[model samples]
Target chain A: MIKFSDKQLAIPKLMRPVYLVTAGQSKFDRAFPDKRTEELCIDALTQAAEMINVTPAELKSYIHTCYYGHFADHFGDQLLGEAVIHDRLGLDPLGNCGVKTGGATGGTTLWEGVKAVASGYSNCVLSMGWERMDEVPTDEGNFLISCAADKDWESPLGHIYTGYYAVMAQKYWKVFGKEEDSFRRTLAEIAVKHHGYARMNPYAQSPMKITIEDVLNSPVVAYPLRALDCCLMSVGAACAIICDEATAIKLTKNSPHKPLRIWVTAGSHTLRPADRRDMAIPLLPNETADQYKDLGKKFPGGERYPGFTGFLAARMAAYYAYNQVGIKDPTADLDVIELHDAFTISDVQTYEDIGIRPYGYGRDYVESGDCYHMNPKTGKPGKLPSNLSGGLIGCMHSVGATGIMQVFEIACHIWNRWAEIHGDDKLWKKFDRKKPADWTDLQVKGAKRALAISHAGVGSHVTATILMDPDKLIKKDA
Target chain B: MSMFGQVHVKNGQYKIKGDFHELTPNMPIRNSDDGWKLMGVTNPRDMTYIHSYGGESIFFESLSKGKLMATRCDNKKCESKGSIYQPFRIFCPDCLSKMTVIDMTDIAKKTAKIHTFMVCERSGAFNILKRPIKFINIEFDGVCTILMSYLAVGEPEIGMRVVPIFQKLDPTYTILDMAWVPEKTKSNHLPKGFSF
Candidate 1:
């Protein structure tokens, strides 16, 4: 409803064009047993700053703001890290702080950084996120999230997080009249695919390859959600740099290699859980059909298309970005996608919600191999990938840091710098021509147009960002 | 048949005992204006009575079946002759005015909505066993005020509805019990022709 531009038919001036330029992350795993949150954050910040060819002193003057994302108690602010970064680097910016909003914290911070550069507030801004969850006992960590539930009603009645989600899952089954195995298989297939992709990501927390059989055999935690269907809590940090076109060109000109320019199209945050009118309905209804019909109009084609479902919030956010940036067909328009996969079930759901498949046909989309890592559906073999950096399932989830990592991965892939680091065993090799069955061609013929979606569960907050190739924008000249 | 006894002992001697005392009929104790008064007694004529005590008590008077009765007062501020209670009072507690009694048995078994509830995980003197208890506040239908009770359900949602059930313990005493279940049709055993 809030249109940023009308005449230009592109991103509004309020939401300026900014490029990712540089993205760096520390190794993601449970291997860092003794490492504190501050240590992990500084390591990640140092890596990202070094890649941009900017000294700490130079970064301080240009960075208008900094946001740190972490859910762990003391680590949420990373007080010690903030002090060390400022003192050691001798760079004190105007603003620097951290925030938390559960698992969506990472993506939220990245969006904030994007807003900063787009709004002309700062030429260069840094957003960093890290979590040291493995340091604490599992019971204590579980208690932190559980404490958020309504104490008087739900909590006292023996309802925990698993039970809460299980009840919703049960309601879904009851209403749809679907078998439990059907839902279980959907989660298993997604987990297996992400696990397979993790083999190509060096920073994945659990990089070992897995099969559908393995996923099906995994221990069930909450009925349909098996052990493999869920994500692991590991320790790591991801950071990104956002700057205007002039600053981006200047920074890349001085660099040793070409930089990745991420042109953000649209971004927004939507309603919380308590405000929702209907709880039983999917988070985002089929936008192309339901939402467009309500507006009394249709797209260029007369067909009433299905919208994304699984990662409802993220998928909706992505749709807004695509619409704002003049992208009508995602399958034919975008080259790659990096979405939050909090659970394997969410990944399959996202495929459906994002219009990658027809309604109730997400499973077929995965089985058909068109959306596979190296598929030629978009005409480029092994180019149009989803969650190429292993996503949240493969990477460590420091709640707020996961979303920023999605943007960072897309930036690295577009810059062609990602494959150079494939030498590291920590990085997984996703595209293997020898095993053609394991790889699918996306068929993307031109440069890449990337999309990212972020979601916050407690309040049901969702945000989406779209990045198009700078060359395309240059050609359009609008 | 009647039985009575009396004990006797010498006043100043510890070693010697006296003969048995005579057992006589003692007069009932009474309160006198000029002498010592007994524990619980009131004068009939001189007592300042708040109201006339004649015919039958209001509670007993109403149990005769079809009679709709209430206490009456002459106060000018009496609104609707003061609100009526089940036993029916003649005067209002605020205005002290007489009120007309109206039959409310037709609507007595209706439902109420729960306002709030608290779950008690621990009960005094009980340990090693966790018995969940809920304390709820409910607003009855057509009643402006709310009542508090121990909710029978283990967990109470905010807007659950409940029905009141009444049982007569004796000719002089009656008990009221309320229970909440998922909404359903009233049982056939309920009084016929009364809408809930």
Candidate 2:
């Protein structure tokens, strides 16, 4: 099973063989009005057990630790969510933890589990992410979510989260988008692609396809960002089981299905984006580069352009993940991706953040067909297959579970049966930007590597986890 | 976090601290001396903030009386030489020492210039804006920190000279009670002091 000898691998001491053994999510919906948080968690866990081809008791026995990630407090009355879940699961709670990192909660929980296994503290761990938003109305939900911003500074100023993203989108347009409604079209492409992609995903919420005109005509929730531009809030739960390399091998060897060796290589995060961090340079080109020749002579860290902190944070996370995985070119190196496209414009900014595309060209990149969903006739990826699970735009965002669900989708591709399982009759390729690639749909056909990225609360938190197909990666490296 | 894990609320056992009272706010809707003119109403989202930190309490008191108070870090080792801070800096950011309060309370508060701004086309908590509200980031003369406030009077231009216009209606107001606009008059100015 070990493809590389100890001498051939320059394995960093900080990194280890953390593998994703199984992943599962309860089908996301606009609002699961009747379902409770614990109910969703149980449903997802049951699905996960079924996918792993193990009974509930057997799977429960394999888990050494459990980490739960849930964001908002107003959603329910479970302050002790992890403890309550443990009691419900009838499992040992010795090394269990409840993690909350705003929206990065799931990614952080997964990271904590990875660390626990890597540190030899536990052999097998479970990360649970769930949120029920149907209990409350949109306004109250937005109000609760807004409370997560800088209360002393941004919140008291009546700053809404969408407003924050809107202003950034406007500036990004001013700098990168150039023409009047060109950026608008770019945002439409993202929404259209993701929604069309979701149509194929049975687990998605917004599987309906929309046009650039549809997005343009949609009610402007915030300037430049239409109702369609933002993702629909979801009610769902997702769970993933992580194990050490030995356990993963044993599980894979014993299974009747095909070999699925998914390695959790690296995970990166940027927690506090708004806090006192040094701004290396201004994001807006309005500020002349020469203005910072001796900027520290007056301003401490140069001009404080308080925008795109989340994007910057995501970029930082991607930088570290790439470094850990020894990747120089993300566009060529990675196969599939599931990023947080809570907003269409966010996905545009995300291309720049992930180093797949440069700054000011995220919209242009999509316009060039480098990341299109799929080509209908050829049944191949147009550019790169991103958000194949339809993403938050299609799959629905249940707050905490969104990130975990992204990871779950990546695992589906590595498992090989991703294509035959999800029937691809109706799709989201209504838009254009036809790029080149001959890979099949759903099955990221010869994909050796994949990444699932998530951002929490207006870029205040970001996590990038790179998972690789062990056999292909090791063979290629060897 | 220690306080949280220190058993703040275990098994839902906690002491009730106070009784609840009905809330009534001093709304901003203009009331014409009622019997003589028109009836007045209020903004339902009216909020009050008692900012009593880092020289903020005194700063608001001075702003109500129309004064532009700034503070300077007194530490000899301060990073920036004679750098000015507003809403008043309590400690020197560089050397971490107490700051020296300075009142640049000029009748010619006209020294400040507009840096950047955006028009809020959407209505939110601030009902004061019937139309799109114009907000600006003002850079005061010799001040190190930027001041974010509303523009009350005219269309703001970058580098436009402006001063504070204190609220005429609200008797109890914060720094936001006043807005930065073109320096049109000096009659409403209340000269407080030169230093604190």
The DockQ leader among the candidates is 2
Report fnat for all candidates as fractions from 0 to 1.
Answer: 0.00, 0.02
- Kindly list the per-residue Cα lDDT of model 2 for residues A199-312, writing each as its tens digit: 667677777667878888887666667778888788888998888878776655645333333323222222222222234432221234564456334433223433332276
Candidate 1 lDDT tens digits, A141-229: 45444444443223322222333333333323322214456666656766776766766565667665777789888765544456676
Pairs of residues clashing in candidate 2: A196-A428, A310-A459, A369-A433, B27-B42
**Deviation in Å, model 1, residue B108 alpha carbon:** 20
Off by over 4 Å in 2: A1-15, A254-278, A281-310, A375-380, A424-441, A474-478, B1-196
For model 1, how does the per-residue alpha-carbon lDDT over B41-123 read when each residue is reduced to its tens digit? 21122111122223324433343332323333345564432233322344454455454455443333355665444454322
The global Cα lDDT (0 to 1) of model 2 is 0.64
| TM-score of candidate 2 against the unseen true structure | 0.74
Report how far off residue B58 is in candidate 1 (Å).
37
